[model samples]
Target: MTGPRIALFAEGGDWHAARLGESFAARGAALVRLSLDRAMLATGTETGVELPGFDDGLPDAVLVKTVAAGSFEAITLRLGILHALRDLGVPVWNDARAIERCVDKAATSFHLARAGLPTPATWTTEDREAACRIVARECGQGPLVLKPLFGSQGRGLLLVERPEDLPPPEATGGVHYLQRLVRSPAGLFEDYRLFVVAGRVVAAMARRGATWITNVKQGGEPLPFTPDARMTRLAVAAAGAVGADYCGVDLIRDEAGRALVLEVNSMPAWAGLQSVTPVDIAAAIADGLLAALPQRRQLAAAGG
Candidate 1:
């Protein structure tokens, strides 16, 4: 079989993109790395999609590494392009639907709960009074973690220890997403980031945080972790719940030592997780994506 051509969507010339390009090249797959901002979409075109340096045609599949922040319209258009590509029968690993669901914290929580996965109690509301009520109730029990509805890398996160410390809904960009803070019995702030690919846990690592937030981007240190059955099962289930072809599932253990799903990232970065784990994550991802191309073609042939 001919090697499948792949389109890697990310911020151009970044470390992750460059590394992925090298991995794909080593696997004998052609890769076209371009930003979503550069992919043109139109109504009257052959494929209705025009990516930079792909004058021949679209690739066999698309791998989304990063979807840059943009205005509402810009973001919508970029997602629309991915949607269009899927409608045209090209496989989009972690397609637009999964990306949209994972990007919205509220949606991710709902899906996890629907799949019977344990997640922190979360409340989101546009009404300031209603949001404040949630904060008061949660604070009465324990500290609350206020997070942006659409964010990652632990940015814009706030710990509401006191009811009076709660910010208004407007401060949360017109929506308050609060979760009950889960404490570790040992009083150490840590969590597990399990990287799942194609419904399997490819690699995992424990993150030790300087404070309550254990995200690597928040100054946490990554340590090698051998995932137990429970952790691996929960991570895989969470990824399936979010409809991700590949993802990073964050698992935090509460005071009772029972793990709870924290978040599922559809376009997860593996640099930190790679440092501690011996797994060549880039190669694994490349193999999974390449394997998917043949399966996609077979499905199309079978009218699936």
Candidate 2:
């Protein structure tokens, strides 16, 4: 019998892809690296998607490491392919629905709020005047962080301290996502990233930035952190809220010392976390993906 074949959806030559490949290899699994941008969808009497390199057949499961950046239509179509694969009874880890919910900051916040998770107050609107009012009203009390509705790694983030400082609606591309910037009680510009796999907090790290944005890609330094019960519960709940099989849940401390969720990422890069943490996250994720294959396939086949 052949080992479970997995299609890794990530850009070629990415370090993450190499690491994941090694982990899967150790587990006696075969991984085919393919870029979603290069993958095409074919529909007919029998609908299926095709990757340029995976001509043999569709894999048993797809492990999504990254979703490439593209125009709205392109991104949607890429996610649609993942959706198609899931519909065809192939297990897609962090399935299309989960990716959609997490990629869109507004949707993630809504889900977090709905679940009564400790997330910062947030507002998303397309109306310029409405956004201005929201910024003006909220900024007077404290700073509000303006961010792209669909982005990661803390890019394109602005901390608006004054109403007049708010970018015009046209500048924001007609949509605005604003969240209250929670200040740490200790006055440190830091946050915790809890890496969760299969509903457990597998590893964690504290990221302290020179300023407010604490993303590792943004020059933040990562340090190993021990997870407390509260942190574990909040991170796990946030992941569940976004329906992610594995994810990175960012949390910050408020002035009153309460932990609040900042964001949840379905397709998270863990190099920074791995550097400071001792856990073999890649191995854990690989094991989880393999373990989920049989059950996920069963669920998909049963119309679940």
On lDDT, the leading prediction is: 2
User: In candidate 1, what are the lDDT values of residues 220-242, reduced to their tens digit?
Assistant: 99999998999999999999998
Off by over 4 Å in 2: 45-47
Candidate 2's residue-wise lDDT over 195-276, tens digit each? 9999999999999998999899999999989978999999999999999999999999998989999999999999999999
- The CA lDDT of each predicted structure is 0.89, 0.90
The alpha-carbon lDDT assigned to residue 181 of candidate 1 equals 90
Q: How does model 1 fare in lDDT?
A: 0.89
